[model samples]
Target: MTKRKNNNKLELIVAFSWVLEKVCDSEFSLLLPLSFFIIEFVIAIFLFFQFSKEEEEGVEVAAEEVSEEYTFQHTLAGKLWTENSFNSTAFKSTILNAWKLKNPVEIQDLSKNLFLFKFSMKRDLEYILRSGPWSFYRALLVLERVTGEEQPSDLTMHFDTFWVRIYELPLMLLSEVIAKKLGNIFGSYEEMDLKDAHRIGTFLRIKVTIDLRNPLKRGTVVKFKEKNRRDHFKYERLPTFCFIYGRIRHQLKDCEAFEDLNEEGFEDIEEQELSYGQWLRASPLPKVIEDQKKRDSSSGTCSKNIFNVSSGQSRCKTKEK
Candidate 1:
């Protein structure tokens, strides 16, 4: 009986301590204390969840803000920008000096590798594109000129090029012919000395920048009449510029064939300047042939009565070799 009373006393003490922890009011039902404890626990759990949710939202907002800043500032993108080796000041100064851009309002960094230059002048933007395809520290910098659109649209210029080899013709003469014949379709041309000429052929790099608004971009082939022969050729993007050797990459201007020609001197070739109207008059090949005949007659005994199969197979007219 005494042991049972002691256990009862211990239970009562524990109950009293739990009630004291729950509520200040002693007259209230113990059930109210239990309900109050459950309410507080639920409130704590809700607050914890809300905090976590707010933290996640904050992170997402920060990320979005960073992306917006990048887009708002950059007007150009390329390998040069990705490296972050430069800043807006460098870009502004270089471009302004090189391209003669006047009064650029703002220049800012976009992303890690892009830049934006704000100009009030529309011509300033055009100047950028016209002066672009830049090389800085040996790395090519590609620029995209933004037309100040709120949303990005198709704004790329597409061009095609091909390697043209003119056989049995001189470089200057053929260039003149090509320039005249292809002036409408050919945006520009560069004489590519990718390889040594075979004492006759002329090599050139012809690049045709096509207007996207034109039908020629849809696989159109270029055709022209040369030497009474109708000829057709296609444009190609050739890996021609050799950054190291400063020659056409694929043509190898330093090829072994040119060594012999370099040793023996060549004629002081003169370029014949012909107007556009003259190129259309007739075939210039006849004039070139006449000139060649004159040269051969004077130097190679063409005027002499040489013994030939066409003539008479008679006395030897062969000069000492």
Candidate 2:
């Protein structure tokens, strides 16, 4: 339709020029200056429209090139939740060693403490996500798989996956359905450990992708068949969190909530009223031994990939490689 319009405009200009030439060539000599002004005005309009069309095409081409360059696939973007600066070289070397990928991957810094991990294989990408939440220098390494055209610096990474153990559930409620329900309450439920389904242990472990923006949930009261029971939560591989806010992003000293309370003349009182304690941090379980135990387990069939996360089913909307 635009092409047709352009053609019609060109034809009109041509006919107008022909008539103008005839008039200029004839006895209409007094109107010569006015004719010249009309001709110049027509030429200016045509040139303006012509240049605009070319500019539009050029802009469209440039946009396509930019989109292609920034488009990422099988990639993970990460951010270290800390105010302190870290050695980029050490971070790259340590993360490369930690991943242990069969194929080499590219790790690039997006900003201060923000990194992007581009994977050659989807399997390698999946492994990194499943085995999280990863850390560096005791600071929580928040991971999110890359999707769409989002820049790494623009990515909001307040969520990370953790194996949260819910202690004190009755034998009857110790099922996957119950586990999913409890896991959702904390964050996004990923997977439940069913290796020791038959054996009742101290706690039931479930993989949950939780938001660090919110304070960690202390515990919840469960009511089943009119029977009320209390359950406690313990997060494995938990990183630095604000005790005052129950948030994992910062410490009590760096907490905004602490600052607000302090401003209200509650500094001394709030200092002793730390809500979250060291009990929230779970004891470190040996990764190698746990993998070995999962391998030898004969009771339940589970995913061979040690990382229990499934991106499609994740409650947290973040990406990591």
Candidate 3:
């Protein structure tokens, strides 16, 4: 009996050992696949972080270069001297005179290569003066004739006007007429000043610059009439008074004669031209319906008047019989 019990215990030990070995193999099989997956996931995460960091560094470097390049290229002297000015007419004139004085060769040259540059410089100066210091550098970048380095050498770089009075009527009007002529001469130019006085003043200065390159030599002092030529009554006494009268009327914006001439009520008319006519044009249908109703009411009144007249005529005829 003892031997039999010992044999049974030995068989039990053998079975337990086999089961333990199977369990160990199953756990190893599952863990091996999981370990390989974890290793691949870790590698992917590291590569992603590395690429992101590189891209970020590249962007930072690009931004720095762009800002540095802009600073190097942009300069303030370009706008103040090149672009047109809107502020004081006297100031704009002074600058334009200086520019024209400096760039005579280009203006006289018919090839127009230098003409663009001259005009660009003029425009840049105007922009700088009107926009103030902020746009100075940007305007300089766009200037064609004058370079950033040459601006300081050419311009006075300050605001100063010498007001002088001229006794000659022709010279006084010279500024306005010359400004228009110069604008016509240079098709690239545009008059940005909207106020009549300011526009006239700016144009006059530009003309002076064109005609007299060295305005200082010609006498820096300019005397403009405090009141325009329209204020002078002598303009009306001339034989060609009508032409002068018309021009003055347009300039003053309050001419009684001009108003009389526009008696047809055409001055304020708004014109709208259509390329093609449509069968149905857009309109307020409700307004059309209301107008029709009013017309119908008037027609009803007219019909009643006719009926009354006919009835009265019939009664009169019966009475006469």
Q: Which ranges in model 3 have alpha carbons more than 4 Å from their true place? A: 1-68, 71-73, 77-127, 131-177, 180-194, 197-321
lDDT of 2 at 8: 59
| Candidate 2 stretches greater than 4 Å from native | 1-58, 61-71, 256-273, 285-321
Taking all chains together, each candidate's TM-score versus the true structure is 0.29, 0.65, 0.18
What lDDT tens digits, residue by residue, belong to model 2 across residues 1-321? 468557856786787778778887899967878976886687667755664554556633454456565446678898998887899999888877666665888888899999888888787788677777777766788888777568655798888888887888888777899999999998789998875444546678888877787889988999989988999998876777777778776676666677666665544654346888678877644454455565554344433322222221111212333
Those runs of model 1 whose alpha carbons end farther than 4 Å from true positions after fitting are: 1-84, 147-321
Top-lDDT candidate index: 2
Backbone clashes for every candidate come to 4, 8, 19
Candidate 1: the clashing residue pairs are 81-113, 82-113, 161-236, 240-249
Q: Of the pair 1 and 3, which is ahead by lDDT?
A: 1
Error of 2 at 152 (Å): 3.5
- Error in Å for residue 187 of model 1: 14
